[model samples]
Target: MNTTPGTRWDVIVVGAGAGGMSTAIFAARNGARVLVIDAAPEEGGALHLATGQLSAAGTRLQRSKGIEDTPESHLADIVRISKDTADRELVWLAVSNAAATIDWLLDDLAMPVLPEHPVRGQNHEHYSQDRYYWGPDLGRSILAAVRAPFRELIDSGAVTARFGTEVVGLVQDPEAQGGRVTGVVTADGEEHHGTNVVLATGGYNADPALFEKMNGVPAYADASYRFARGAGHRLGVDAGGYTRNHDLYLCSFGSVLEHDDFPAPVLCRPVHWPEMRMPWEIYVNVEGRRFVAEDEPSVDVREHALLRQTDLRRYIVFDGRMLREAPPMIPGWSADDVRAHAGRHPMFHVADDLRTLAASAGIDPDNLVATVEEYNANRDGEDPLGRRFRPLPLAEAPFYAIRVQGMSITSTAGLAVDAGLRVVRPDGTAVPGLYALGELLGSGAFMGNSFCGGMLATPAMTFGRLLGTGILSW
Candidate 1:
């Protein structure tokens, strides 16, 4: 579909990712003329890099497998994992419609999820039931599923997609009309008028300035899509929409960075799963105190524990004997790589003594020595942090420490939206014609301070489908 310069559209969606595509497809299927504008050179914004993990309860796949599940169960799991900080109404909406979203992909779009999927997820906190899902090609598989129908809609002249176009600002009605959104203005100064505008511009994880502004902490790693610079966030703010959820910022535990640079690109992530590799290294904070059990089973506990530390940074401490004898601490790295990178890499350090090792890693020397001594002394008894698997002592010479920091793959803060997906002001008044879906509304909206599996992408796709199907009145 081609767009004429001044033609009015029924819906204008910014960002051509999972949520934006879903919104355009559903809206067009409902007989609306939809125009989608994205800043990327091509569509599939973050999906190209996303893991595409999703979760839903009581879907046809679950039923066929005889797996007992329900939306109520899904809602309960998310609230429990999020510690009740998640917006209840938004969680309810996402979970309620999640099954339908998954079914649409599987049954309608004929997308193939792994046959043995719907399992408890491994990366984040595990759901009680087997509700997690992913495709063989990760996020690209999900994009293929959405893009097929979306292209069909485009060919039918119901949806028009313009890539390499950025929505710089939203057009709003007069102050007399409560400043309702009217359309959007592109970076090229072209104004596109529409009855409804959906901001699916994703998150600001890629922008260090906005990441620190919204999250109250500096971004530690550059792991998100580069185009996710929070354009929709700015557009929503310009249209009188407020943002929230800064207090709910959460970070993943460990990522090996390419260098010592702040917001450094990730080289590889370390595998800290106890089941995969038994405890050989202990994690210590800047104060040189053990913050969490080295072999803690729950990833959520480890991540939350890291949040309380200074700057959300920690060091993995191990001695030469353990480094040589224990299973590889960093995933995909040979034991030789660990030894080689220790003294050479900016993120890794090694010294002949405990105090020297502590000094090299910016840890308090006295406290680090005491912490290591305490662990060595308690080898036969229950560990102070209740660490059950104390396989080796850190008494060997030539100690090593690998600096690690908390990092997030998604932005936690975003434009505030009501239950109907309408962007709202700080005073709680809706900005008519402006709706937000997906990461533009923030992962904190549904996932809270915890990393809830499938909450981000699932809700983005679900709300996009709902909004396109006329769930909100224009």
Candidate 2:
């Protein structure tokens, strides 16, 4: 393939985060002159706001620990966890090539996991095998790990990066094969031509309007990477690529948002994992009804139950006694500290009685009183929701309610792509010279309606490695 005249880059990668950096690094190493561009002042994309959990089977660390695993088993878990809703072909592609990607991170990149890693993480549905891993520093560790190699490439001039630069449009030829994407035009009105253009822009979680438009739910938490505002999604759609998996949107039980706003920053995450801590409090929806069993063991069950609620929100309701007698509901904040915030914070509401408490927290007052009455009456016996951990009742006075909103940091809808990861048309034909990786591919493609451990980050880098190694050609 002959290089285009006046085209300064072999591959122009937009969004210099995990997938983009990995692509640029390996593409440059493979002898392609790479150009990296990002809207943010620096790279690291979602990793800055991510937990950076990585899942892989048959990695060097697993082998060292005598833990035998395979992509087949990993895929089996994903299918089981996602209820067979995930895209099989794309998932297989990522899983089959995942081990080498993890090995590269742990061995070649010198990134180390926690001492007792490879555990079935508790946040999401646990994978059957112990294959999930992350470093102590979480997302930042991955940032540090990938940045070293990317920095080396940057210093060597094999890769050229422009920070604070946004790719406004992709230069395409309608006459070419399937709207061939030849280059990208930056916001500054400068065209940077390349043989290939990769859209690795993260997700739409930070954009409330786009989040509601895409997922059919208002973005409740502004916890995603700030730069993830659907630039990649719009770009891909404009380039003749379609987005899919819109129906696979799923949210966690929730987090304590800082304000009553539609989209607010997360103040603190609740330790709602029953495995980590059993519930002494009850969760009531806006209808003031106990929807799911508070002591539900399956995280998936809890998440789905919350999904059916009115606003993907739940109020953690408890009595003053539950606060004093039970384990601390919210970590770092004790009973006294919790009392300090009651009636002061918008999220934390307190009342002398159940009706007042409900009204204060925007709950149905009469329904809340009835719900609490029913809950207290069935404290020692069988619960309607089949909740097993009913150690105490919501009878104590000065009732409290802390509002928690269910939200997702990753966008569920993403650009449609073929197994080779080329952004594809609705007819499943690849758009020439256009490829998409990472969250731009949507978490739904990997985990479907469920959040599988490490599926997002692992596959992002793995697909990047695959494309850089051999998939992409000039």
Candidate 3:
């Protein structure tokens, strides 16, 4: 493409996810001209599908509850969860600004939290204090608060938003003194130029090839925003940014996929946590044997164990008796719904006998039989291998199996950046005028190696606001 006349703006944010939109709002509000671009027709990227869990520390609620949590405690929790693998400085920055960020959302951004108010942790883990909350509709609620402000800025001509234009490449000002990025070239050969660019394009969870190359593991599922395709990541790399935290890539626990396309998991209703689904059901690997405690308290512990196992494919096997007696494992499902779910979904496989079920599902029949027998025999014992929840024996006939695969919607590995959110190269030099936030910066930065409640949505909102309003303030 020919070098077009470089257009100038104070900030150009790539991708219209929570991060990009949040940044655009702040940047525009801060008396700066901003343009937000996304490949999709709509602005909310993966927010449509996300559960929208957010975490913060030292909030109004926390203070009212008399809960003592410093930014250091928040950082400590993240580091401990990540086993000291995350960027400490960035973690500190995020945790330190968390309360102010949340306050901004609640007061100025029109964010509305649930009535429960400041629950420590309901869906994921417990924070040191009660400072976690989600909007009524989760992703939609946050988007509702953010979208209008962004659109208002665009309407007033302070912020320009161009959707359906995918950023294809980064344009560096070679003749410029600093290695500044002058513009971004779209797929359709249009160049949207700016003085500073924020890469809020989200992660590579949708691109298996890029994910495998960067993360060193096969992209388990195409579960994120398809447009997110790591456009920002590729652009960052092209502009000489170095990626890190690839080793920290982690997968969500037990998704029973419906088809090749991901986010397509038949049921992703957090079957493992809270030990909510009765443990009469045992998870078996391709070898047809139980490996770890089915009801382990930590999703991370179960996930790490699954990664160590062969194929990372497991079958949840439960007897008819338990199926009839226990509460529906899946939400909004009657027993008939559960029965139909087995045959209707691709991941779900069923059979009348253990032998036939194993053969049909491609698991070893003998091993499955042994596993079931061992589980049944030792279930009542003081201590049983692979038994943490004191689940009933799997002795009834007509056993059922649902195939669960490890998957992740957020990319954990991402471009390395400093506390300022500037894209940094491997040599530790800043990629001038380039910044990254949200999933494009990877979840590993905030959540660490663990999925600590609201790291995904919250940090994106926080960092995007901070970068646009705070760091980039001139």
Candidate 4:
């Protein structure tokens, strides 16, 4: 749909991802005329690549399995995982409405969720209850569910979606009106007026420069949606919204990249979870010292440990014996493929001894040898770093090292918003007619300093639904 210049909309949503679509659909259903603008050729921003993982308590799916859960329990789990760093009121809002949002998708939109879902998630830290869920097709499935009803609204003229339209600036009222947002100006130099504006343009992980600037660390891999360039952040700031949670930046472990260069695209993420597959090698930092337990049960601990390493990088040190006997370190990689990549891949190094392997992998040679020797000597006793699983020793010839870097899939800092999802200034006053949700609020707002299962996507949808369904005055 084409957005005519000077057209007045009840709500102007600056993105077409999960958050914006939810806002548009619900607002249209509520008899509000909505306009959704996106810079991409299509809608469904990060949802195209998102895992679509979501968690909620008191859902019918959980009840069907006789799993007793509550919003309180969900809040508790997130607070515990985030170490009380998450915004309590905002988290309460998300958790309390999460089940309703899921039900809206399942019963109203006919979204397909896995039959045996609400399982305890395996990727991030595990929640105490089985409230995690995802569709077989991942984010696409969730997007499809939202898209169907959204398209119906568009067809009926309740909503107008303009793809390839980028919102360049937010139109703010004069100082007498507290500088409230009036509408938005697009990159095409068209002004569209609206009663309220919602920013859902996702995160900044795809923009290496912005990612490094915001998080104060280099983005090792480019693995997020390409359009996530922090447009919402910049626009919100221009309209006097204060950003927060910059210090909450954290990275996840186990991403194998296509190259050793900065901002390299991820080739694949190896399954390093001990429960899924016991580790057959030791993980060492640049100084060749063991950091976390190779078989650490908690993914959160392992990820944080990796963050403390030099340059947030580590080397998975193993030997020829491990290559032959243990499970393949790279999931789905064949033995021949592993052998081929050992010397051929830029991230992989193979040498006849620990010293040579360290040299090739840029690790301290003496420290690498000493670390391996200590592990070999302690095979009969408790291992350092509290490692419980030591399946093999690096005693065999042809020691190998695979370089891995800690990386993030989302931006941690973002525009600050209140419990009502209204963008706020540095003094904690609300910016009238302005709202923010999704990754525009930053992964740190909900997930805090850690990765809470299903925190990001679910809250984005919940806040969008709330804003669209009369949470904001027209």
Model 3 clashes, total count: 2
Expressed as tens digits, the lDDT of each residue in 250-277 for candidate 2 is: 9998999999787899888878989889
Which lDDT tens digits does candidate 1 get at residues 1-474? 124666888999999899999999999989998999999988888999999999999899999999999999999998899999888899999999999999999899888889888898878999999999989999999999999998888788888888999888888776746887888888888888888899999999889999999999998888899899999899889888889999999888878788867789988777788877777888899999999998899889999999889989889899889888887777778878888888898889999998999888899999999999999999899888999998888988789998887889899988999988999999998998899999988988898999999888999999999999987665
Give per-residue CA lDDT, model 3, range 52-107, as digits (tens): 87788888766776777677788787777777777787777777878877877777
Worst 10 residues of 2 by lDDT: 1-10
Off by over 4 Å in 4: 1-6, 472-474
**Candidate models: Cα lDDT each:** 0.89, 0.90, 0.77, 0.88
Model 1 clash tally? 0
TM-score of each: 0.97, 0.97, 0.93, 0.98
Ordered by lDDT, highest first, the candidates read: 2, 1, 4, 3
Q: For candidate 1, what is the TM-score? A: 0.97
What TM-score does structure 4 among the candidates reach? 0.98
Clashing pairs in 2: none
The TM-score that candidate 2 achieves is: 0.97
